[model samples]
Target: MPTARIYQRPKNAMQSGKARTDRWQLEYEPAEPQRPDPLTGWAGSGDTRGQIRLGFPTMEAAVAYAEREGVAYTVVPAPTKTLKLQSYADNFK
Candidate 1:
């Protein structure tokens, strides 16, 4: 039988060949430096060193702020966003 053409050769023939593609990638994603957060995997213990505290009349208020800020901060990927945003005002009684 006549030898098969190079392109039609079976893969088991042990021939080395290069591939060509008509398709091309459009946009290339930017390369970013990925590093784990230093404070990640933190175990919430009773340690307040170098940390800020929230002061509210009721424990519920503090808890609510904590939960809201935590969720919003993560949901929004803006450098200007922060969970420590505070509102303070004094009203004369």
Candidate 2:
């Protein structure tokens, strides 16, 4: 059996937009460690499951799928976001 993790997507650091952050994602734990390829020196892994990512509209849906598949899974709570309210004028201070 493979172990998986369920969590909500976080906002991308490169952009101010919050698009796609509402979806939950399921990712399998690495079955094997990555090793540098002998030819290209790029990191590679034989575990194809590591490349798979499943998205669900809600956390419950994600968990249900994992349960139906008999996959051992752990739900990682999403990190809380704290907003600091400030006006553009504050930048001048």
lDDT of 2 by residue, 14-67 (tens): 999999999999999999999999999999999999999999999999999999
lDDT of 1 by residue, 6-93 (tens): 1111122355442321111111122333445568954344323214422344334434554555422111111242366555653333
Residue 70 lDDT in model 1? 46
**TM-score between candidate 1 and the true structure:** 0.22
| List of clashing residue pairs for candidate 1 | none
Q: How many backbone clashes does candidate 1 have?
A: 0
Q: Using alpha carbons, what is the TM-score of model 2?
A: 0.93
Best by lDDT: 2
Give the Cα lDDT of each candidate.
0.30, 0.98
